[model samples]
Target chain A: MGAEHTHGLHLPGQSTVHRLPAHLKIVSTLAFVLLVVATPREATWPYAVHLAALMLVARTARVPAAYLATRLVVEVPFVVFAVVLPFVATGPRISVLGLSVSEPGLVAAWALLAKGTLGVLAALLLAATTEPRDLLTGLTRLRLPRQLVEIMGFMVRYVEVVTGDLRRMSIALASRGFDARSPRQWPVLATCLGALFVRSYERGERVHLAMLSRGYAGSLPVLDAAPLRVGDLVVAAALPTMAAVGMGAAVLTR
Target chain B: MHVPDGFLDLPTSLATAAVAASAVALSLRGARRELDDRAAPLAGLVATFVFAAQMINFPVAAGTSGHLIGGALAAVLVGPWTATLCLTVVLLVQGLLFADGGLSALGTNITLMGVVGVWTGYAVFRLALAVLPRRIGSVPLAAGIGGFASVPMAALTFAGLFMVGGTAPLDAGSLVAAMASVHTLIGVGEGVLTALVVGSVVAVRPDLVHGARRIRAASIQAAAPAPSSGHRA
Candidate 1:
């Protein structure tokens, strides 16, 4: 989704949302998700408020609404899970559109659907705004620990290479009359994965030897600074505050 | 089996996050000792490989598809501690950039997929190696079983969390049975890949494998004694 959206959906807009610190964006996104999750399902009004606030942020961020929606298609499976919830959940029954549904189940379904969709959008907006490298740097600065961060930096860098390897292996298998759809062809599929793994392990060995030849101590050198400016705090505070209000209102009314 | 955010309740999410964070803390200390400059970059590449491996979903059954969790495979290829860090990186990247998982649910994903997946799988793989007859084939066989078992173990952990914290009224039996059934099938793919990979690497460079580290050392020692006996006679 990130790759596709980067090329087609992400618009180059001159907006404050785009300029906000990546760490702040990450922090606030978490805060907002907590607020949404804390909000009770019994209270629909608060959720409505939360949704409205998200739209305002989207507008502020200058993310194309269509693009946001397209990116959000990743949440489609959860929607399926939600659609089935009413049928499976045992609760008081009600009728909607001349069909029987569980009352509590409907609420549960709504809760899952709304919160899941909003959470995914929060992420999409973050990605649509920040570059992948900047996000890794931000995570590193967020005190996520150096070992993890360095690994993430390299993982992001080499994902394309590893994926290319998988593609090549799959093509090789296909050329050798390996039809994956047949149940009898499990051995061929297994061999493809086996070959891929051996190649990957060898690659890991060579990469290790290469890194060692360079002056790599236990940790990667920390060079860039991730300063949390006052502006970042201000931007980070806004969404959470709104989310808190949304949750409080849900609790009070319920 | 990435569980998206909000599928789990707050308590479950928070608890899992705490566990994940602590495990990461421990792993960081361990990695500092295990990773010299050379291994660190390779660990990064392995993580990237896991990420790409995940994207290539091998078909499981008629229409269902599953991706590589790569926890056990990573642990077997790299050390377990390094593998934990690698899997953590993969999860973070997937969560933040790809939006494949919920940002809020990052801890839960890491705990189940990274820590539990790597440790449990690696432990089982090691145990199998210990109990089995010392043979090169057994190394991959044990790794295969370990990789297969780890997926359902992760699923079981999720089931436990949901049983406690889930707002949905799913019965424990139905949920576990459903999750186990699907994951057991997924495990087959995991085992095959892990065994084949670990086996091949052992064939080429056994010294590089952390799980096979002891086994390789033992084999080398045994071979050295035989050659020396021939020279002495």
Candidate 2:
């Protein structure tokens, strides 16, 4: 097993959704998720509307349903959480298949699943449409600290390198007849990790030297990307604007 | 242990976001002072290393297995400030690309894992090292103390936050107890592995271990030009 996998999250397209500035998409995504988080669990209709609106964006962006299915695997823990809620919750008991479950717990479980799923889909959609570099570019213009953003950029670049080193080390261990079938073998693994750290740190020192030789003067070249336009703002605002409306109607009606 | 979106209420989530944002701000300043020109690429590689390290799995029982959490380990390898940044970067990338934790929940995850975990682990490492002999051998034991405490502290903090803003009406006390006890076991694994890694590194290259710095300075007559310093002028 290696650290290799398809790192390509940004689905390239000529659609307007793909053309929208990264910063605006980031703002819109955050705004949408915030609205979902704020809505009361009883306001279930808003959540359905949120999903419908998300599906519309996904359609426009041409996000593959299969890719999203893989992305939503993050929901498994929440599902397990929802499963236990009914049993642990205290409320009026309702019998189903000869087993009593709390009524309040059932409602709570539905609330968690609905809100959690909507929030995740909204984020995944953002990832699907935006290039990772543009996402960082968006973060930079949003006034995230320059140094932190720079570090994040490096992480994006070098994650594969370090993980590949790890895979090779693990393979080396296996080839030497070391089987990590139990925790007793973790010390050997830990030793390997120690070695890996030394290698990574040395590589970092070499990179520092490389940067210095290239005249890195304590900062990266300033990123001056202001790609958003008035029309793009309206396009970006559409999702959150609808989310805000859904939130208002949810509050008033529910 | 990434908390999903719906678990925490908005007010609680916002509060944590503010807290995480401030801590990151502080860390950016601290890391600049610590790493300076090297902050960008160096911290990036450290973040990548932590990401890679967390993937290593160790079997616990007949079937169960667990992976490294790396906060305490990172604190020992680098300082707490850089370690905090490393974790934030890892968590942010994971959230943006994989949706591993919901964006709305990012603040809470950063607070629990980065700020609370690194600070507590670093503090415990310092305190544990203080009581032991002033030698590199004591480094790993101190790291173990840090690793042991960091996990439960983060878990305890999460339990506290849940009590304040949990969406569900689950009993707060039970949640706290469960979170603390389960993490204590995980912390045991964390502490042991931390000790092992730290010990191994100290044996060969004490200078690489941040927590072993005092001992390295005391034991060596000169900066010794660390055989692996990569030619610092």
Candidate 3:
């Protein structure tokens, strides 16, 4: 969980991209990703266009290119899988640099890398520009289930608290000379997790009691119910619209 | 695990999304019954705890580490219904906030991790509980087995989906074989983590555990007759 907060990826700024409503940003990001997903694997130029658009948004949001590049390590597993595909895939063989690889596998690997990278970039842009709380608020405004939203709000608030608890426990374990580096040490790690869970569950029960005493009902009150503005809608629609046009052209030309 | 977009075709993605939606809807109804006033907050906390737990990577080998998927662990602590919702919440947060998983692949992730992972893990837990000794000690063992089995099951499920609409031309047999083998190793990590967590909770607060409810109920029944007989005598 120490890594969870570190990887939250939000950088504080008041840029116009950051100023946009969370719902608008969410919609725009989803639309952009959908377009990326639907694009044919062979349509390499469309991805280039998508990347350029992402760069423009990133520049507007003042997100560093290096930061975006670093965050992409999350896709390393898929990258590995993509890399291995050409070697293992069964298809017409092609020779590149004296290495014969499956032709279809190469295409698949390219599609995966291109589309996956674009999708991750779009998601990163959204996370970088918007606060987590604001994103939940945006989900709520986007008409996500109230119960789900409430649960998510609680999760966002307490993930760090639990992780803090985990850190202290790890410190305690380390103080006791319990370093879990081997399978033999798994029991100790598990016990720590077990202890952490019990503590969290009890804390949940106590918090519920405290809230109940204060006349808390099933639902928490929503403080902000701001409606989406026309300007926000127009701005949000622009990215999707542009992507759609690109997608349409790509499909028609193909 | 966290499948990126374009791995599966559009039809497969949309289909899995539909399935995930229905599963969540069903879980919502089931969670309503599971989460009473006292339990509602615990459900949220459970999700947060899983979120936190998933962040702590335990070393499985010299170069490999794995974290708790928390499917069986959550289902054992809370009900399976609540566990699914918790996982879904975790996945959503990770996808939206962390950019860890793909937005287009959200449905597929939810289906695999939330639906398949939780249900299969819970099923194995229940099966183990039925066969194992009826002591509180058995809860963790059963959960551990369930947790261990769940990882490979989820991996196989992904392989099945890939067979249907994979964006690549790879042979299905090799994909399944590779996925299952790697995941089996990860499952060992999952099982140990689950057992440790479940055993610890059973030691301290057995009543809070959903999977151990039958054992608690049986214990109460066995204890109830003595007090009532004394009163009658």
Candidate 4:
């Protein structure tokens, strides 16, 4: 919605968390999420520790609690979906707030809620601290396929251009006194997207021709060859390393 | 739906990551055949276009609106392989940048939306096109059918995957019913929109549509043999 702000989730900051290289952050976050998923969902303490670590990172990055909370709203839909488990799941019944819910489903729901929260927050922290371009660079450094990386590069580069076009077209649709508020208006809305698609496709063809003229020989030049420093790796490894410790404890304690 | 982490167990997530990686790799090679040298820029733009297309919010109820999941539309416009690649990038970016889908769940998302969604939609589209007629005008309707079916198919597959690796113990019948039924309704809106959109583009440039390109070629071939008739136009 914020066309002016290209990378919507990223909040600009100068903290040490933001200073970490994106590739390192990407690996660390992935490791954290894997750890979160692999954790014993029944272990209550690990979930709490995971949240604390996430909050600590948010603090270190200087991202506002209010901002992170607002962004965390994306997980609300998953919460809604998980609530149905209690009603549908087959298990011993229990009463909560005068409502009968399955006992096993209740535990499962709690696990889902906890794990989903930690996982989402961990991801949000990375995105909030890193820019989109840096994320791609991180992918490249991690040795994702060259063509895929370049495709992603073009995607990152032209997202604004395409989105700007969409914004303008949306305005044009609004200028005509049309509000897409019901299923009946679907054709009109889709027609707008269709026109957008045609224009974008033509533009793509033109772009290809332009690139061919400019000596783009089916490959983009690779950059970001700087070696990963040991200190930076240690810094990036800190959060995930702590989570790994907590995970080991949780497994051992159980 | 972009399944966030914790919905599926680690084994499931890891398995899906493997599945997603293989599908993306296969699609990358197939797209090279479909696009050749023009693959990089065009597919990238198509990815952005799909990203933009997904921004369309269709009103489902009085207050609720749903976003368009664009496997069929993208496949019909671009080819299926490119659509797969494009959707994968859209998903990867969404995961990395927006935190829209989960980081660990990236493989799951790509598998569902990119592989299941695109291929199911495409298979149905090609089938619909074959069954209905062999003309350009049939492309939109076929695409609509594909779009309509893709959602529920994905939802059904999600139910299956969830059953296999769900962290919770939910009844299979209820799970499938819930996922499939809701997505079936969502599919109606998607189907209509996809049809209208494809119809719009097909009207302007049938040759531009990957689905309709064969019809263009057929029409050209039909005209090619008649030398006298070729002189008239």
DockQ of 1: 0.48
Comparing 2 and 3 by TM-score, which wins? 3
User: Which runs of model 2 end up more than 4 angstroms from their true locations?
Assistant: A1-8, B221-233
Leading candidate by DockQ = 4
Candidate 4 to truth, TM = 0.96
- Model 1: per-residue lDDT, tens digit, B3-39? 7778888888898899989988888778766655554
Per-residue lDDT tens digits for candidate 4, residues B20-127, read 999999999999988898888889989999988887677878798888899988988899999999999999888887788888999999999999999999999999
How accurately is candidate 4 docked according to DockQ? 0.73
Error of 1 at A192 (Å): 4.2
> Candidate 1, residues A68-155: lDDT per residue as tens digits?
8877777888888789888777767899999998888788888888888888887777777887776766787788877678777777
Q: Give the DockQ ranking, best first.
A: 4, 3, 2, 1
Error of 1 at B21 (Å): 0.4
Judged by whole-model lDDT over C-alpha atoms, candidate 1 comes out at 0.77
Order of quality (TM-score) = 4, 3, 2, 1
Q: Identify the superior model by TM-score, candidate 1 or candidate 2.
A: 2
Name the candidate that leads on TM-score. Answer: 4
Please compute the TM-score of chain B alone for each predicted structure, in the order given.
0.91, 0.93, 0.94, 0.95
The whole-model lDDT of each prediction reads 0.77, 0.86, 0.87, 0.87
DockQ agreement of candidate 2 with the native complex: 0.64
TM-score of candidate 2 versus the correct structure, residues matched by position:
0.94
